[model samples]
Target: MPAQALGLPLLPPSKAKGKDFRRGVNMAITGGTAMNFSFYKSLGIENLVWNHGSLDTQIQWFKELLPSICGREQSCKGYVRKSLFMFGAYGGNDYNVQLLERGLTPEQAMNYTPKIVGAIANGVVKLIALGAVHVVVPGIFPTGCLPIFLPLFGDGDADLDDAGCLKAYNLLPPDQVPQLDAPEAGGSPPAEAPQLDEAHVRGLLRPRVPDGPGAPQVWV
Candidate 1:
């Protein structure tokens, strides 16, 4: 399906009261990271992450709103089972913070990929504990292909790939991809989960390229 058909409209801010969530609510925040600020702080990285809407924060918000969204523990379980959860495209900004603010090279930034992916896996486990049956956890996209990265990192022909995307920046390692098939991350999500294939999800999440001359190029 198209990205627009994913679900309901933008949810009100976490502090907003009495908002409708019957359809669904978007908890995603701009500049949100998988790991919290404290995680970076422990590593002596300061003044890097500006927005504090980390994954843990958003999940906490969901826990608080659950009562209003569905009453009673039993009912909440049913509500969650029937609902679709889109976990993330996290780790993008996690790397960005290291690269842009901490002055780490892309390779150096990749050293934290395991931890970043682990954080997202932990999030999926949380949703599963909350009775989430079908959680769609999207992996990070090709950073080099991003328009923002293209201009910022591109230097010369040596840096560009055959497709003109920066070779160094498009470093989404194979192992870093979230594996829902793992037993810990809900173990293949049962038979009832939405049967979204790899190609379909990729198409939905792919950065939009311009169709024709003067056509707008939209990025996800």
Candidate 2:
């Protein structure tokens, strides 16, 4: 639960001396592709469509919910001006589809990354436009280090971290880690790995930043 409470009122768990206080209604939707469609479509899949939730559905949801929270008659009338918006942790669904459904190599799967990133970046911008002040977009996990990846591309000598994660597969560049340089007396290096980081995320999302002196500060 890597959470942040921004300008939100925190209340006691139980009533004290007949004084009752409670927190605001917090809305959280699933972000991945398995049960979510937004991530699935972004990964370049068009034929088989399935989604419990999508970005469009969420935006509409916020539109309806914001007015009630802000004490207004209608939706999104600047009521969400100071509300916290948690957007992502997306792109995993895209990666999953590429690797599992398409049966593509890591390198091949990553080629479709820009499309997914752009889609996520655009979603963040949409939230900003809707008056969401604090937005938090989570990063994806290291797929190569995931349990499913090892068996898919196992070479018997798969280099791993202390937790058995692939050493060759990480967020850092291959050149920076010596494990990717050469094979040791133990396991082999990873053939490929997804690069997930703040810099990379910000770089892709940068282009969508509003061209103004007072543009909102979005952290992904």
Query: Number of the top candidate by TM-score?
Result: 1
Clashing pairs in 1: none
* Cα-based lDDT for every prediction: 0.66, 0.53
lDDT of 1 by residue, 1-220 (tens): 4555986366566566787886688788888998888888887767744466789888988988899889999999889878887777777888888877787878888677646655665666566677775667666777778887777777888999999888888874332333233443323322222222232222322222224553322221
lDDT over C-alpha atoms for residue 144 of model 1: 78
Once fitted onto the true fold, the runs of candidate 1 whose alpha carbons sit more than 4 angstroms away are 5-18, 173-220
How many clashes does the backbone of model 1 have? 0
Off by over 4 Å in 2: 2-31, 34-50, 71-78, 167-197, 204-208, 211-214
Against the true structure, candidate 1 reaches a TM-score of: 0.72
